[model samples]
Target: MIRGLYTAASGLVAEMARTDVISNNLANVNTSGFKKDRAIFRAFPEMNIHRIGDPAVLSPKDKIDPKPFIGVLGTGSMLDEINTNFSQGSIKNTSNPLDLALTGEGFFEVQTPGGVRYTRDGSFTRNQQGYLVTGDGHYVLGLNGPIQLPDGKDISINRRGEVFSDGSFVDRLLVAAFADQRQLLKEGDNLYVSNQQPLPSNSEVIQGALEGSNVNPISEMVDLITAFRAYEASQRVVKANDDTLGKAVNDIARL
Candidate 1:
């Protein structure tokens, strides 16, 4: 009975973590360049049940097998990891020349408080210093460094992520790719850091466009419902175990 209670409690905790991931995906359905998170779980090792009884002295010729192969049992499960899906999102055109979007695998370089960071959010703007920056004022890096636009000249980002003004090349955007994307760590605020080997650039930029969030609302809703049901079932199991324990102690044991 006690084991059953612990198993149900573990299930409840795992379901709660799944619920959090689903809710976060739903909440970021409209966020630009946002990736969805998935919850992974693994079962814990099973406990060994051994028989306890008095044993008499055995004869010299008699022998007994101390260990026998019992059926495998699961104690419980826990959240193993949270995986990030880097699938491309749909692009929307805003017609703003400074806005850019990557059509393939890549990440835009941005100067953040924690040094250089990477992002897929290409929605950029010119700051007061005439420098291209993200919506949150992170400086956008280019081949030569931070890209600075010319005054009163219309800025255009070509398919090669080159910044041009009056048909003259000003700077090229620094786009980077990872050989192993799973090694990248999410630092929040639409930024990621990677320690894996960098891959050759293969992404093209499209000006006047923005990448949409990768979250699918319909899928997230379905996941939310499943998590809720699982949590509820675990709660029922816990309640049932409690009732059985109560009866055993107060009624059966008393009788």
Candidate 2:
């Protein structure tokens, strides 16, 4: 009875973790360059079931017979890990020169207070200092350093990440990629950080466009409902075990 209670409780905890991931995905459905996270589950080890007080173990004649095997009992399940889906998001045209979108696998390098962070968000603007920066005011890095645009100059970014101002070549955008995308960890502000060395990206940079989040609201809603139902089922199992234990301790003890 106690084992059942613990098993059900483990299930509840796993379902709650899954619910959190799904809720986050739903909330970031419209966030630019946002990726969705999936919760993976692992089952606890199975317990072998043996018949108690078997007659084969006691009697000499029955000693020749094999012990009876009942079956295996499942303990419960647990949350394994959260994985990010790095699929490309839909692109939307904004007709703004600073707005960029990647057509392939890559990330725009940004210089943050912590260190160099990478992001897919292309919604960029020129700061008061005439330096190109992300929406969070982080400096957008170029091939050499932070990209700066001269005041009152027309700007354009080509497919190869080259910046042109007033029909003059200025600097190239620092686009990067990772060999193992799983190593990249989210550091908030739609940015990812990884210890692995970055590779030069061959991805095309589409100017005047922005990438939307890849989260599908309908699928996330379905997952949300499924997790809620599973949580409720585990809660009921815990309650049932409590009632069974109460009867065995109080009601049966009275007799």
Candidate 3:
């Protein structure tokens, strides 16, 4: 009975974790360059049950009597790590000269206060210092350093991430990729940080374009309903166990 109570409790905890992930995904459904997260679960290992203090149970080789194999009992399930899906999102054309998007796997390097961060969001603009920066005003890094645009000059970014001002080559966009994308950790504001050395990305730069979040609202709603139902079922199990314990302690003891 205690084990059953523990199992039901674990179900509640796991469902809560799943709900958190789904909620976060739904919240970021409209966020640009956002990637959806998935919650992974694992089951506890099953243990073998045997009859105690029985000679036949200990000695199964004896033909006179044989030990019986009992059914397995499940302890509970646990919530594992949450994995981010790095799949490409839909590209949207805004006709804004500063807006940019990547056509393949890679991230744009930005200089933040903390350190260098990476992002897929390409909505950039020129700051007061004539330096190219992201929407949040973080400096966008280039091959040499921060990209600077001359005032009153038309800007053009080519497919190969080369920036040109009045048809004069300025700098190359520092787009980078990692061998293992899973090593990248998420920071707030759609930024990512990683310890792995970056590799040259083969992605093409699309000017005046931005990427949309890859989250599917319909599927996330379905998952939310399922998680709520599972949590309710676990609550019922816990209530049932409590009632059983109450009956045993009060009613049966009085009898």
Which one wins on TM-score? Answer: 2
Q: In order, what lDDT does every prediction score?
A: 0.89, 0.94, 0.93
Ranking of candidates on lDDT, top first: 2, 3, 1
Off by over 4 Å in 1: 48-70
Model 1 C-alpha lDDT per residue in residues 1-255, reported as the tens digit of each score: 999999999999999999998998899898888889999999999877654442433667765445544566679899999999999999999999988889888999999888889999988988999999999999999988899998899777788888899999999999999888888899988899987766667899989999999998998999899999999999999999999999999999776
**Cα TM-score of candidate 2:** 0.96
Q: Candidate 3 residues 146-245, lDDT tens each?
A: 9999999999999999999999999999999999999899998999999999999999999999999999999999999999999999999999999999
Clashing pairs in model 1? none
Error of 1 at 237 (Å): 0.8
Q: Which candidate model has the greater TM-score, 1 or 3? A: 3
Best by lDDT: 2
Judge candidate 3 at residue 22 and give its lDDT.
Answer: 99
Model 3 TM-score is: 0.92
Per-residue lDDT of candidate 2, residues 40-122 (tens digit): 99999999987765555556555633456789999999988889999999999999999999978899999999999999999
Model 2 has how many clashing residue pairs? 0
C-alpha RMSD (angstroms) for model 1? 2.7
lDDT of 2: 0.94
TM-score between model 1 and native: 0.90
Worst 10 residues of 2 by lDDT: 58-67
